[model samples]
Each structure stands twice: as structure tokens, then as C-alpha cells.
Target: MSWLVTGGAGYIGAHVARAFIEQGIDTVVVDDLSTGRKAFVHPEARFVQATILDGERLVEAMRQFDVTGVVHLAGFKYAGVSVERPLLTYQQNVTGTVSLLGAMEGAGVHHMVFSSSAAVYGTPDVDLVTEDTPKHPESPYGESKLIGEWLIADQGRAHGLAHTSLRYFNVVGSGTPDIHDVSPHNLFPLVFDALLGGRTPRINGDDYPTPDGTCVRDYIHVADLADAHVVAARRLEAGDRLEPVYNLGSGDGVSVGEIMSAIADGTGIAFTPEIAPRRAGDPARIVASGELAARDLDWRMRHGLGDMVASAWAARKAAAPAAE
Candidate 1:
């Protein structure tokens, strides 16, 4: 009846953990604090500080918690950074997932929900990527996530293990006061910081083929993403016979320029961005078709871009005083 959430102290993972705790589910968290914060861990859940690569430690935690299912969220997620450090990305994301799967099998935990990414789809020729989209990952990070999904699918076919892999895009917004995002790589937080510091946020490549000439992406609220995980878990727990993949996103795309405008309007931070060349390996437009998730999991994003920006700005403002 209990679940093990890897990287449960991280931004999205912490939100998932909080949602489970609020529903009175017994949970266990395993994180090494590499990028996650101890402050994000819920007090009700048993917390274990360890990496997924440590098979012995992961097995021990699963055994101790009597974990019936797992929500796998541990991985390196930065596309540009992954290109610079391919080996490390593979080691942490790919190899770490392998170790975690091995540990799960050893502990007899058969059901899982994997935190995959739209990065796995890369830049598809089509505007909206479906579940059967061609996966031509551009960076090591994307390839690593694709490998993780393949692992889950293969394990499910070979063994009796059941899983749901939710591929998400541009996850934003806040779920709780104690679990706000601290990563410096993502767009929303970076823009928030630039405005807070009285500096113009840099926009890379504002001359793309899109309507506004800037890259567009689907920005789904983190809470809504967490809700999909809950639905996926429940379906598996209920023994629903289904395929293993679902895209979790808003079915709508927002341009980078649009996001900057939203931040300005929401936070009253008026600052133009400095134009820069396109980031290497960035797709011009990457949106999701969550039709499968909507049909099967009854999942829909309740919050729009405005809501996402406003809530993110709220969290940023609350944390700004301490950061000063």
C-alpha cells in the first residue's frame, strides 16, 4: 500500500510526494540531495538519503518500507548541460535508472510510474507529438530518458512488472511553500532572477519560424503533472490492462516571448531581454498531445499559462527576501 518515490525531495517529485501524503498514503522518499533539498521532504513520509546508483541502499529502503510501487524521478535533466557532460549524464540518468530497476526487482516491487520527458521526442517534424511519435532524441539527456522508458517497457514485457511512463513538457508552477524550485537551469526561475536582480533576461534566438519568431513550448503546471501520476498509480493498482506510455502536458504551446511577457505582467517586472544566438540542441517548438492521458486517466491541466506564471512569481517573491 506504500510507495517509494525516488528523488522525492526535488521540484516535481516533492509535489508528487505532497499529493500522496495529503491523500493519506504511506510513502517513502529516497534522495541524495544532489539537486534536491531536505526541506522539501514531507515529515509524514520516511526519508532516506541515498542515490539510486547505490543498489544495496535502495534495496534496503524498499524492503524496510515494504514498498508496493515506485515513482521513478531521479535523473539529470538539462539538455545543454547533458551535451557538455555526456558521460556524467549517462552515468547518472541511464546507469542510475538501471540500478534502481535492479533494486526494485530484487525487492519484489513490480508496479512503477516513471517520470519521462518530452525531450525524448526531440524536435519532431509534427507540431503535436503523439504517443507513437518518432523518438529521435537530440541530446544525451533525452537519450537517457528514452533508454529509461525502453528499460521499463522491456521489463514489463519480459517480467510481470507493470508501469506507466508519463512524458512531460516544460513543467512549471509551485505546489507547496517549502518545495519551490531551486534549479538555475530552467527558464521561469532564470527570468525571475534576472528581473529581481534588475537585469534583462536573455532570450536565445528570437528569429525562429514560429509566429513570434521565438521557440514555443507547452508549459504545464507541476500540480497538474503530479495529478497525472496519481491517476497512473491508481490505474495500475486497480489492475487496469493498458499500454505503458502517456504524454502529460497542456496540448497548447506558448512562445518564449509570451512567457517573458507573462512574467512581466504578473510580477510587474518590466525588463527587455538581451537577444542571443539559439541554444544548441534546442527545438524550435515542442508541444504535447495528452489525448491518451485525458481519455484513459481522465487528466486535464486545470491551470493555464497565466496561473503558472502568477504562482511561480509568488513563490519567487516569497523566496527573494531570503535570497537577498
Candidate 2:
């Protein structure tokens, strides 16, 4: 039996798919290519071009591939943009999850590892958020994710579906040079694009209450994040009990100012970031404690900030034009 990784062609999903393959687990990837790239999908994993919205197609894929579980990551993921596209976000994330669950039930595939987000804890008041943090999602994307978790939990209760949802913040870095994050809204890519285009990198709202007057967030390397998904999937497959949700955080905080410095150092660029006005709904700080994840899913920060930046920069540069 194989694992089906939805959105396996995207940055983080691709990494998860790669991790499963590396661990000698057969993997089948289903992606719509809306935001995911075909080239990012691992060569060893089976690829199916489809969206999670297509329940019938998903069922067919599970049966054909002999899928036993799913790593659900496909969705419209931009939190800020979700404000302008609530319907699209809900349709892709919430409704798509329903479709996937139905498909899983139909195909007799039970286990699921959902790629939830820290956005579910939007602007948490606590310094170090735990799994019990009160969810006050501020965006449609976050709402959809939280709702997806609820649906999954309900499904688990009703159908005995073994499942776990991983909630996380900024996912950075590249595990391999060929596979890198390409989200236009993500920090690493935005900074890399600025540097490559001979423009100054911009930071939003450097006048926060942080040590450096910038927002502080828990940034976990994408590789480490991907590994957690594999671990959770394996645990479920082995019939091990798991929490309904786990925060895959670094148990630390890194300010955006620090990230800018790291990027500058890693890229060998000497320039101060342009401080733009703080975007609306930007939280001053949001760090999480990955204690639960660490105990159960083998989650840990295997890469440091330097490694994260260096790897991301290298991958971004590799994807750049030859002249760059």
C-alpha cells in the first residue's frame, strides 16, 4: 500500500513526498498544478494530475495506486490574499477536504496527516502557543484550515479514521537544490526575488514591539516540517495513537529583522531592508512550543537559521536565470 500526497507538486508537499520516498515508502502524488509545479514532484513518486475537489477521481486514484493513507496539503494557502478570495479559499480548503474525506472513505483508505497552519491561532496572546491555544483565525484561509481539522476529527470519530493535523508557521529552506519554495507571497522567495532583480528587500512594519521592532515568528525548515508528516503517517499506519493536532514549531522565535540579516549574510548582499508599513492584521509575535510534536512525531529543528537561509538562497539562485 502507498500513501497519497495531495499537492505533492508544491514546495512543502514535494518535500513531504520526497521524504516518504527516501524512507522507502511508496508514494502517489495528486496535484492540480494550479500553484504547484510538475518539475518539483519527485521522479520516484507516482504523479496524478488532479484536484482534491474531484472526489470520484480521487477515489479512482486511491484504488488504482493501492493507497492506504493520505497527506492532505492541497489548498489555497495565502492568508493575506484569502481576505479577497474567501469563497475560493473555502472551496479549495474546506470543501476540498470534504471531498478528500469522502474519497478516502470510499476507497477504504483511513489514515490522514493534514497540513494545518499556525494561522489557526491568529495573533495569539501567549508567548509560546500550545495545542490548546484558543483558535481565533482572522482570515478565510485560517478559518478553512480550522474547519478542516474539525471535519477530520469528526470523521475520525464516526469512521475510525486514524488522523493527525500538523499546525505550523513559516516553513522555509530547501531540502534539495532542485526543490525549493516558490510561493510569491512567502518571505524567502520575496527577498530572493528582490535581490535577484537588483531591488532592495522590503520588510513590513519594523516599528513593532519586538526586540528589533519587527514581527517575530517561528520559522521551521521545510525539510524538518516534511519529516514530521512522514512520522505522523507512519505512526498512524502502525496503529499508534496520536493527538488530534500537533504544533510543529521550533519552540523559538526569530524576528523578520533577523531573517533579513540572515538573508543578507547568506546571499553576501550588503543592504538594509526597506521598511514598509506594517500590513493589516500583522501580528507582533507568534511563537509556538512544539513539545507535543517532539514527543510524538519526532519533530525537531534539524536545521538552524543559517542553514535555512543558505539552503533557501542556493535553491532560489539555482532556479534563477543563467545570467543571474
Candidate 3:
């Protein structure tokens, strides 16, 4: 059966697309290239350059590809920018998802896997969040994602769609030399740029209540995250009736200082960082239990923080010359 991947040319989506290709699955990627790169799209998979907002085009693509399942990963995902452009975020994340679901329904594709984020927890009372955690999103980005998850859940019940929502936190690492983070908003790429440019990296906050007084996040390698998607897809294919929410993370927290230390060790670049006030709406710590994913999907993270940083550093160095 063929699978349709939305935003499959983007960062995480590209990696997941690679996983599907390696499995010999017939895959079709639909991306508008708004933020995705055509270079990241594999030659093995059919690529369609179109926006999901175009419901007719999306439905036509699904039918043309004979799509049996969909992995929804397209949307705007900048937390800070989402705050300033709330309506835009809602339109892309919420409205875009609705459009995709409609297309899927029309094509009779009932299985879906969504790329969600930990931002939905919004500084949960507990340090480690689970799939059942009450969502109290702090930013428009988070709110939009939460709404997407709710839409998937409600649609699944109302229309007999089987779906899974994987909530990820701090997705890092590189899958291949050619595919790297070109996004300006993510933390790892920003730090990589500063170090490669011989400039000091800036730490947003240094007074969070953590051990290092900095914000702590669970960093999961992108390859491992991609593997989790494969497993989730297999489970869906196996006809497992389950809830649609699962948290994918390392189940351990690493502070900003700790990440910088790993980057220094990985890149062998010794540069001090400037401490700045915390950005608005950043949570002190966000660690996921990941127990549900491990138990249900039989998934476990293989790479640690050091591996994540080292791989990212190598990819960053390779991209630097062209980035100039």
C-alpha cells in the first residue's frame, strides 16, 4: 500500500520519508516548499509540490497515488512567531489539518500519523509529561498543535479514522549529510551557526530553577524519532485500536548549559556564551516519560545527546561553505 507524506521535504518529514523508502514502501511526498527544500526529497519517492490548503489538489494527489495512509507533518512551527501571528498559526496548523483530513476522508484513507509537539503540555506541573497529561498550551504554536491533536481524535471517532499523534520535544540530530536543519528558529542550528562563525552563542536564560539555572529539554535523535514513526505506522497497519496521542522523547532532561558543553566537546570549539533574559513562554523543563511509546510501539531511543550534537556538528560544518 502506498503512503502519502505531507511536508515530506522538510526536516523531520524528510527523515521519515527516508525511513519509508528504506522499507521499500511506495511513498508520495506533497510539500509546497514554503520552508522545505527540494534537495531533501528522495528520488525514490514521488514528489508533489502543492499546499495542503488546496483541498481539491490534495484529494486528487491521494487518489492518484492510491494512498492507504498519511503522515501529516506540514505546518508553521515557530513558537515565538506563532505568538505574534496567532491567526496565521491557527490557519496553518488547525485549518490546514482540517483540509488534509477532509482530503483523506474523500480518498477513503483512514490511517494517519501526526507530528505533534511537547509544547502542548505548557510547563506541566510534573517535570515528566505523559500522553494523558492535561494540555494547557502557552503559545499559539502549542495551542494550534493541541487543536490538531483534538481534531485527529474527534475525527477518528466520528468518521472511523485510525490515527496516532506523536508529541516530540527538542528533535535533534541529522540523518544524512545532505539533509540538515536549515531552519533559523531551532536551537541546535542557531548554536551551530554561531560556533561555525566563530561567534559566541547566546543562552536565552540562566535562572530557571534547574541545576544549571537554565531551561532543560529532552533531546531525541532524529533517526530514532523516524524509527518510532515506522513502528507506529506498522502498528496502525496491524489493525491496533488505540488512542491517538503518544509522547516521543529521551525521558531525560538536559539543560542549555549541558547542551553547550556537549557541543563544545563535539565540535572542539571553545567559545563562551552570553546569558540573556529568558524568551517569553519558554518552559523551565520539558521531559517526556516515553513509556507509552516504548511499550506500545516497541520503540527506544538509540542515540544520546553526545551523538546528536556530534552528528549535527558534522552536518553543520559540511553545510557552512555553501551557506556562505
Instruction: List, residue by residue over 200-252, the lDDT tens digit for candidate 3.
Output: 99999999899999998888899889888887887797898656788886788
How much is 299 displaced in model 2, in angstroms? 0.8
- Weakest 10 consecutive residues of candidate 2 by summed lDDT: 315-324
lDDT per residue for candidate 2 within 71-105, as digits (tens), equals: 99999999989999999999999999999999999
Q: What would the C-alpha RMSD of candidate 1 be, to one decimal place?
A: 1.4
Off by over 4 Å in 2: 322-324
True lDDT of residue 2, candidate 2: 100
**Runs in model 1 lying further than 4 Å from the true structure:** none
Candidate 3 vs. true structure, TM-score:
0.97
Model 3 stretches astray by more than 4 angstroms: none
In TM-score terms, candidate 2 sits at 0.98
Identify the candidate with maximal TM-score: 2
Q: Which is the leading candidate under lDDT?
A: 2
